[model samples]
Target: MSEFADQYLCAFRQTPAETELHQAAKRYVSEAEAYDRTVCTGPISKDGILPATPRELALVNRNAHALLTRIADAHSHLFSRGELLREISRVDRLGAPA
Candidate 1:
């Protein structure tokens, strides 16, 4: 296993179970670790996000984007209106998201 995956897989151990973004984080971490495992276990990437193929990269992007959406939905209350708007625009989620 790459040390890259091991690092994040070990970092969020104390997140409360099934709450807010923790839910998506669970799935994201699982998928990331699985992807990391598919590669030859060798020198870990410095960026910790080296995908072996285009499809695998897409999967990672999708999961990460969804996780961020869940994070925004769960904590929108914590953000000021301008902050929320900026984030939404930054992620290109301004044009009718559900």
Candidate 2:
């Protein structure tokens, strides 16, 4: 497994009841890495412009998206309104609203 996949698996290991979520996360990471490799090795035209991505890459992306969505839905409770607002505020470097 790739380092990113291992990291995702480790994150999901926090919840023992989330065995399926862990597997889904691993699959998503694997698929995402495969897509990255495919894009990086894709053929280029004579003019140095990269050609269109293959259909396989699209399918890989869709699979990764589905797996990630399933994992997110299963863990949606972790992202409460307060937590989300805090995260947004942190990213925007602004204090939480009064």
lDDT of each residue in 1-98, candidate 2, tens digit only: 99988776654234543343344444444455555555544555432223255765576557656655665676566543343334433533432233
- Using alpha carbons, what is the TM-score of model 1? 0.40
Instruction: lDDT for model 2, please.
Output: 0.48
- Candidate 2 structure, TM-score to reference: 0.33
Tell me, what's the RMSD of every candidate?
16.2, 15.3
Residue 78 deviation, candidate 2, in Å?
A: 0.9
Residue-wise C-alpha lDDT for candidate 1, range 1-98, written one tens digit per residue: 69988776664454332243343344445554565556534445643547667776677677656655655576665543344435444333322222
| Clash count in backbone of candidate 2 | 0
Residue pairs of candidate 1 with colliding backbone atoms: none
- lDDT per model, in order? 0.50, 0.48
Best by TM-score: 1
